[model samples]
Every structure is written in structure tokens, then in C-alpha cells.
Target: MAVTDLNPSDNDQSFRCTGALTIGRAGSTQRELDAMPDGMTIDLAGVDRMDTVGAWLIHRTQRDRGAHIVGESAAVKALLEQVAAADHPVQVRPDLRPAPTRALAELGTWTVEVGQTLFGLLGFFGATLVGFGNVIRRPKRFRMNAVVSSFDAVGVRALGIIGLMSFLIGVVIGQQGAVQLQQFGAEVYTINLIGRLTVRELGPLMTAIMVAGRSGSAFAAQIGTMKITEEIDAMRTIGVSPVEALVVPRMLATVLMMPLLSFFSMLTAIIGGGVFCWVSLKITPATYAMRISEVVPLHDLDVGLIKSLVFGFIIALGGCFQGMLVEGNSEEVGRRTTNAVVQSIFMVIVLDAVFAVFFSSIGWL
Candidate 1:
């Protein structure tokens, strides 16, 4: 490319650019153009070939130095016009908001998310109930195999961990209770503390939390994977109800097995507490058992079993509901799985508190 500057008069200067004004010559051409005085005329009538880069260079010179473009070719003129038209300001960063305004906006967003989740959960619960009704009306359609598999997965396999955890917890409670009660010379009441607390409160609550982490997260991951793979949709296309095939069996298994798990947890914890009493307090195994039976009332056992059933339902419902809500990609499966565990545990704790108040008011305390 060649660039020539001409001055016919002191007040008249023309910067003439010739040859190809394409990307190949852009750097050199731009350097030459940069030396031109402001408000000079840029004459491109001698330009043989031009491209977008050439047009952009011309547009920039015109914008920055108030230079008038004088070109002859229709193609060059169109390219320059197009490049100038396309150029516009773009905001690269978002505007910052005031602290209180941002806080309120975040609160509003959170409130809306909570409301949507609650609405969706209610719909899922209704669908689950309808699935149960369909099974009742057509018992042959029920999935016994799925229920058995779920029982094995959620209950039988979980016994080891639950039993071990409960045993450790019982020992800690027994040791701590004895420490405090010994101060008042009533260390024997440690039996009451261990037995009552294990059977009535800690047993079911701890089991629910563990199950939420283990089986509830599994439920969400399993169903969410099926959703991402379009298996749920394929089932529906084949006239198979996903709720009946996928959800009902898991729900039934969880509800049925929870009571058994809770009972086992209670027994293991009491045995642990009894062992601590036998070892530390010089109490016999028989005496510890007798004291536990006397101190922990029957109503307390009922309270625990009842809470186990509700907690199990909530765990199953939360996991399956969040799983069904999964969309888009595999990353969503992990997110929904975490949500399932958190939602299940939170609901279990909240409902446990409600049950405690209701039972106490009805004289079950």
C-alpha cells in the first residue's frame, strides 16, 4: 500500500491512501493515517481493494479527527457505512447497586424461589398420592420388585452405620449424663437420661438425618440421572407412569423400613448405654436393663416410632421431588441431590419439633 499527503493550499490538505486497504496492509496504513492532521480530508478514490478492517480504520480516523472520507468505489462506501453502523458502545461491567437496595433485591429473589419450591413440592405430593391410589385400584400393577430393591438399598445396607453411630452416641450420652448427675449424687438417673433420650428423641432424629445424607441423596441422584437420560420421558411415552414405577416403591420401602431402623437404633443405643453403666458405675447388665425399662415410658416409644414414619415420608418426598425437578445437564443432578438432602433434613427437624409440641399437649410427654 502507498499513502501520499497533498496540500493544494495552506488551508487544504488531503491524505490520499492507495492500493489494497485490507488487513494485510492495515498496520502500515493506520500508521500513515495517524500522522495526518485533524480535520483533514481522507481521499480513498485510489483504493483498489478494501475489507472490513480497512473500513474500520477509515471510520476510526473520521471519528477521532473529524476527517471527511472521500471515496469513489460503491463497495468501499458500503463497507465503511456498514462498519460505522455496527460500531456502538458496549457495557462490559454491571452497574453497582446500593447496599440496602441489593439486599432487598436478594431477599425478594429468595422469597420467590421459596414460594415456587413449595408450590412444586405440593404438586409432587399430590402426584405421589394419586400414584398410590392407582396402585390400590390395581394391585397387579404394583412394583414389588422395586420395593424390595429399595428395602435392601435403604434399610438392610444402612444397618451397620446406623448401629455403630447410635452405639457411640449412647456411650457419650451415658458418660456425660453420669458426670452431671454424679454432682447431685444421683448418677443412677443416668439410666433415665440415656433410655428416655435414646428412645424418645435422639434415636429417630439421628436416623432421619443419616438417611437423608445416605438414601435421600441417592434417591435424588438416581432419579435425576434417569431424567437427564430421558428415561422418565420414555416411560411416559410407553404409557408407564414414572410416579408409579419410580416413586411409589421407594416411598413405601422407606416408610416401612424407617420404623424398623429406628427401633434397631434405639435398641443398639440402649445396649451401649447399659454397657457404659456396667463398666463405669459398677452396675450389672440385668440391673441396667431393668432400670431402662422402668424409666423410659411406653408413650415415649410411640412418639419415636410415629416420628420415624413422618420423617421417612418427608425424606422420600423431598428426594423424589427434587429429582423430578432436575433439568438441562449432569451438573443439575449434583445440585438437586444436595438440595434433596438439605431439604429432607430441614423438614425432618422442623416436623420433629411440631410433633414434640403436639405430643406434649396431648399428655404424651
Candidate 2:
């Protein structure tokens, strides 16, 4: 095939092609076309094996000036059709709203379902206690290892974090109190404020929050994973009650550890408070000790310990309950673990409030 150029005038230029415009040859053709005058027509009658790039160049030339193709080949026509189609825009509509009333109704239904589930859990706990009592009478099918493992996990593992947090809390309380009391020339009384607050409220509350974040989430994830794998069912098939094997031991461990952990936290917080007082307020250790001794009563310590124990029980129970409810899926395990931490923290705060109200009403505060 031959390539020929026809100049209709000094300005009117056109090119005639008579060969395949393959990818390799298209680049040379493009350079030749580029050298032509701006308004030029290219005829593709003799061209063969037209591709997307050649079609695009033709379309672009037609857009810039004009082109006349004498050949009506199906491939060329199809490529031109595609280029024409590409120039049009597509419209899309997006749906952004979900039905609000339907969502509210579903939420209400879920709340009722959760309430019923809690009721069933309480019933199950009662029955497990009865079964435990009967089993104790005969002493059969009991695993000591599980109990010991749980105790170590929930108790020993939680001690360090609880101690550290409590100490920091004490320092914060002491520093804050010292700042306020310094205005009244009562900087020495900061120690009294720290001791009283730590022993009565902050100690138990902080300890409980720490445990919820640490051990409570651990319990939920462990049990929830077991549930997902149907290990709880396997345990039941082997004549082992899941509650006896799992929940009871955890509950016992938490109940025993919480008060002890709270005590450690309280001590650390007081030590922190002491350091803050000595450094910030320039109060002597003797004066701080005397103030603490005068302000903190034995009953206040008792109340805090009691609150810690209660918070521990709540945390353990919430963790186990959420874990047991896990529905044998990865998402469910994650959801339940989150639920355990949130529920445990909420319960701890609510119980703390209740205790505060009771103590205040009875003149303990």
C-alpha cells in the first residue's frame, strides 16, 4: 500500500493511508500526522487492523479539525462508536438514609431481648450454685487445675497494673488538693484529703476500671473464642458444666483478688500522694502522716474494700456473661469482648454511686 499527501491549497492539507496501522506503525503515522497543517483531513479507507489508539487519534483529529474516512469498515465504525460513547457522562443516584423509626423499633426489641437474657443468666447461675453444692457433697468431676489457672490469670496478672494506676491516682489527688488547700494556708491538710478520698472512693473505682480493661476483656475473649469453637458444647458432652468449669472459678478468683488489689492500689496511691505533698507543698512526712491518721477512719477503709469486692464480682460476672453469649463467630467474639469491658465499667460506676449514696445517707461520709 502507498501513503500519499494531497494539498488542496497552501493551507488545506490531507493524508491518504493504504496499509495496516498496527501499534508499532501507529507512532510513525502519528508523527507524520502531527507535521501536517493544523486543519487537515485524514482518510482511513485503506488502513487495516485498526486499534484503540488509532481510533482515539482519529477521533481527536476529528474533534480538533475534520476527517473524512471513505471506508465503512465495521471495526473502524465500532471504534468510532466507542469514542462517541465515551464522551457521554454517567449519572448515579445514592441512597443515604435508613428508616429511623425502624431502627428505633429494632433497638427496643434488642433491649428487651438483652433483659430476658440477663434474667436467664441469673437463673442459670442459681442452678449452677445448687449443682455445685450437690457436687461438693459427693466430690466428683471437679477440676482443680482450671480453678487455679483462673485464679492466677484474674488475680496475679492484674496486680501490677492496678498498683501502678492507683499510685498515679493518689499523686493526682494529692497534687490537686494541695493546690486548692495552699490558697487557704491549709497545705498540710492535702494528705488528709488524699487518704480520705482514696480509701473511700477513688481506690476502688480506679482498681475496678483497671481490672475491667485488663482481666474482664481477657475473660470475654477467651470464653467467646471457646464458644465460637463449640468447646463449651464439648465440655457439656463430657459431663462438665461450663459454669462450674469456667464461670465459677473466674468468679471466685475475681471476688478474692479485687479487694486485695484495691488494697495494693490504695497503698500506692497514698505513697504517690505523699511524694506529691512533700515535693509540691513542702510538707514534711510527719505532718502528712499525722493528717492522714486523723482523717482516715477504719470504717472508711472497710467501705472501700467492700466496694472493691463488689466491683470485682460485677466485672467478673459481666465478662463471663458476655463471653458465654458469644455466638460462635469472629465478629461475635469481638462484639462480646467489647461489651464485657463496657458493661463491667458501667456496672462498677453504678455500684460505686449506690455505695456512695448509702454511705452518705448513713453518715459514713
Candidate 3:
């Protein structure tokens, strides 16, 4: 590349660039052009060829020094105009909202999402109720095979873990209670504590938690996978309700098995506590049995079974709701499964609190 400066008189100058002012031809006219006398006009008519770099240089010199282009080709002129328009830097403004305003905006958004989720869950529950009514009217449509499969999956397959967990919990509770009571020469009260708590609270609470984590998560995963594969859609198109076919069986199985599991959990826990007492406190097994019978109220067992039934319903509802919410993909299956378990466990605890308050107020304790 080459640039030649012209001066015919003092305080008047013009520059001419020539011979292919293009990148990779070994030179640029940028420095020579920028170093020219102030207000020097540039002539590009002599240039053999031009590229983006040459156009940008010409555009920049013209923009800064008011250089007059003499005989630039139309293509070069258009390129210069485009480069000039795009070269200016953009400025970004920082956020200026007050802290309280931003916080309130986030809170409002969260409230809206929560409302939508609750509304969706309600719709699913209503659909399930409709399906239930239809099945009641047409008993032949009820799927006993699916119900039995769900029972085997969630109830029979889950007993070992549930029983082990409750028994260990009872042992820990009895041992700790015995130590504390022994300090007051009241070790006999350990039996009372274990019997009442296991019968009225721990039995249902622990069993429900186990069921939620196991069955509820599975429900979300199963339905979510089916949804991703479009099986649910096929059912809908064929005039078969997916809820009736998939959800009802699981719900019925849960309702049927939860109370039975809770009852078994209660018995195992009582035995665990009794064994611990017999070993650690030198209390005979016969005496522990007598103490359990004397201390545990029949109403406590009734309350626990009732709570288990409600907990089963809530767990099934949570699982089905989240499963149906899955719109697409395997990632959503895992996400909805996690949400189902967490939501089921949360609802279980909340219901337990409500029951405690209700039973207390009604003098059922």
C-alpha cells in the first residue's frame, strides 16, 4: 500500500492512497493518514482495490478530521458508510430500582407461580374424582391388575425398609427416655412415652414419610416418562382417561395399604422399645408388655390409623399432580419426581400438625 501527500500551498494539503489498500498486502495507510496535517482531505480515486480495513481507515479519518473524499468509488463509499454507522460504542445503564421495590417484585412473581401450581393440582384432583365416579358406576372398567401391581411395588417391596427404620427409631427413643427417666427414679415412665408416641404420632408419621419418598417419587417418574413418550397423549386421543388408567390404581393401592403398614410399624416399634427396655434397664419382657398395655390408649391407635389414611391420599395426590405437570423430556421427569417427594413429605408433616391441633381440641388425646 502507498499514500502520497500533496501540497500546492501553505496550510493546504491533500493525501492520495494507491495500489491495493487491502489487508494481507503488507501495509495499511491508517498511520500515514492519521499523521497528516489537520483538515487534510483524502482522495481514494487512485486506489486500485479496497477491503474492510481500508474502508474503516477512510471512514475513521473522515469522521474525526472532516476529510473530504475525492472520487471514492460507489462500493467503497457504501462500505465506509456502513462501517461508520457500526463503529460507535454503546453505553449500558445500571439498574436503579430501590431494594424494597425489587424485593416486592420477586415476591409477587413467586406468589403468582404458587397460585398457578395450586390451581393445576386442584384440576388434577377434580379429574381423578370424576374418574373415580365413572369407575364406581362401571365396575368392569376398574383395573384390579394395576391396583395389585402398585400394591406389590409400594407396599410389599417397601416393608423391610419401613420396618427397620421404625424399629431403630423406637430403640433410640426408649434408650434415651430410659436414661432421662432413671435420673428421676422414674424409668417406668419410659414405657408410657414409647407407647403413646409410637401409637399416636411416630407410627403414621414415619410410615407416611417412607411411602412418600418411595411411591410418590416413582409415580412422578413413571407418568413423566409416559408423558415424554406420548403414551398419555395416545390415551387422551383414544377416549381413555389417562388419570383413570394410571393414577386411580396407584391411589387405591396407597389408600388400601397405608393403614396396614402403619399398624405393622406400630407393632414393630413397640417390640423394639420393649426389647431395648428389657436389655438396658433390666426390665423383664413380661413387665414391659404389661406396661405397654397399661399406658397406651385405644384412642391413640384410632387417631394414628386415621392420620395414615389421610396421609396416603395426600401422597398419591401430590405424586399424580406433579407427574401430570410434566410437559416434556427426561430432565423434567427427574425434576418432577424430586418435587413430588418433597411436596408429599411437606404436606404429610403439615397434615400431621393439623391433626394434632384438631385431636387436641376435640379431647381425643
Candidate 4:
């Protein structure tokens, strides 16, 4: 195209076009437009043909409707008009409500979001239940390998950390109780305190918290990555239900393993407390053992194990739910993973309180 710049700095400054204004010549046109000042007139009557690329450049340079266009054909004028129309700013009225009203409005929005999330979780839970039913009807369709892998991932691999944490907690409880009871000369009751606390509360709660941090986050991260990569979509396309293929085995494995893991945590914690009491408090191992046998009821152990079972369900549900919520990118995967951990821990504590109330009412506490 041939172009002539006419008085580039003045209102009459303009250029004449003589060739196709296509993407091929967009760069050159942009440079010419840039060299001119604002408030110029655009002489487009000489343009052979202008496309979206050319129109966009014209729209950008004009900015505030200061540039007057003297165009040749109907199509070119229409294109320019279409492009320029989009530049008009949308008008939005201000929200003039008081601060309290806005806060309530925001709270409503957040409540709606939370309700929707819970609804999705309930639907996913039902789907997982259906998946379980399908597997029961056709056992061969169930993936034993995945269940075993989950066992290793959530159970066997987690033993060390859970064991260590529980042991230290027991030691702390034992030592603290010993110190306080020494004042009353009831130092022997230190084992009583440790046994009741560990079996009734600390064992299951600590194990569940540890598992939430480890396995729950893993579930969210793994499933979320699969979603972001479209692998979950691929599973659907191949007639595999993601609920069956991904979530059910995890649910089963967690439910099955949580009690066992918590039992291990219980034993380790008792051992740690027993050792501490024996060495630090002059309480013999035999006396500690006898004291626990006489004081801590089997019902307390049952309560903790039952709590662990419920906590397992909560942790798995929270992780898988957050994972399914993920969309778009790796950033979302990380976000949902964190949500999984936080939600699992929160739900575990809430359910623990509920169970505590129920147990208390039933005379089990």
C-alpha cells in the first residue's frame, strides 16, 4: 500500500491508503498511526479494502472519537463502526448501600457458595455409594490394586509419622501430669490421666489429623492434577466412571485402615507414656500396666476407634470433594489441596465434638 502523511501534528493530519489493509501490513499501519498525534482525521476513502486487523488499529489510534473518518465504501464504514462501538465504556451505577448492608450481602453470597459446595459433595458421595454398589454386584470390576495402593499410601507409609507424633504427645501428657500430680502426692494417678486421655481422645484425633495432612492432601493433589490434565475426561470418554475408578477405592481403604492405624497409634503412645512414667516418675512398668488395666475401660478404646472411622470418612470425602472442585490450572490444584487439608481437619474436629456430645448423653464418656 502507498500512504501519504498529511500534517501529522494537527487536527487535519491524516494518511491515504492504496492497498489491502490485512494482517500482512498491520505492523506498518500501526507504526504510521503511532507517529501521528491525537485528534487527527483519518482519510480512508483511498483504502482498497480494510479488514478487522486494520479496523482495530484505526479504532485504537482514534481512542476518544476525535479522529474523523472520510470513508469510501459501505462495508469499510460498517467495519470501522463495529470496531469502534466496542470501545464505549460500560456504565455501572455505584452501590450506595451502608457498610452493614454490604457485609450482609457478601455474607449471603458466601453462604450460597458454601451451600452449593455442600450440595456437590453430597452428590459425589451418592455417586461413590453407587460405585460401591456396582462393585459389589460385579466384584471383578473392583480394583484391588488401587485399594492396596491406597493402603500403602494412607496406612503403611503414614505409620512412622503417626507413631512419632502420638508417642511425643504421650510423653508430654505423662510428664505434665506427673509434675502437676506431684503437688498432691497423687503422682501415681499420672498413668491414669495418660491412659484415659490417649485412649479416649488423643489417639484417634492425632492420627486423623496426621492423615489429613498426608493422605488427604495427596488425594486432592493427585485427582486435581488428573482433572487439570484432562485425564479424568479421558476416563469418562473410555466408559470409566471417575467415582468408581478414582474415589471408591480410596474411601474403602481409608475407612478400613483408619481404625487399624489409630490402634497402632494408641499402642505406640501408651508405650511412650509407659516408658516416660517408668523412668521419669519412678512408676514401674508393671504398676503402669496394672493402673491402665484397672482405670481405662475398653469402652473408651471403642469410642476412639469409632471416632477414627468417622474421621476417615470425613478426610476422604473432604479431599475428594475439594479435588473435584478444581478447575483450569495447577494453581487451582494447589488451592484445592490446601482446602482439602483445612476442611478435613475442621470436619474431624466438629464431628469429634458431636460424637463427644452423643457419647456423653449415652453415658459412654
Best by TM-score: 1
Query: Model 1 residue 259 lDDT?
Result: 91
Candidate 4 Cα errors over 4 Å, as ranges: 1-43, 53-71, 89-106, 228-231
- Candidate scoring better on TM-score of 2 and 4: 4
Residue 236 accuracy (lDDT) in model 3: 93
Q: Each model's C-alpha lDDT?
A: 0.93, 0.82, 0.89, 0.88
TM-score of each: 0.87, 0.69, 0.78, 0.83
Ranking by TM-score: 1, 4, 3, 2
Q: CA shift at 127, candidate 1, in angstroms?
A: 1.1
Q: lDDT, candidate 2, residue 232?
A: 97
RMSD of each: 3.3, 9.5, 5.5, 4.1
Model 4, residue 169: displacement in angstroms?
0.3
Tens digits of lDDT, candidate 3, 39-128: 787888888788888787777777788888887888778888888888986758866789999999999998998899888888888999
Pairs clashing within candidate 3: none
Candidate 3 global lDDT: 0.89
In model 2, residue pairs whose N, Cα or C atoms come closer than 3 Å (at least 3 residues apart or on different chains), thus clashing, are none
Error of 2 at 333 (Å): 0.8
Best by lDDT: 1
Ten consecutive residues with minimal summed lDDT in candidate 3? 25-34
Q: Which tens-of-lDDT digit does each residue in 21-140 have in candidate 2?
A: 656677787778777766666777887777777777777767775656556478888888798678664658755457897799789999998798679668756855775675577666
User: What's the ranking of the predictions by lDDT, best on top?
Assistant: 1, 3, 4, 2
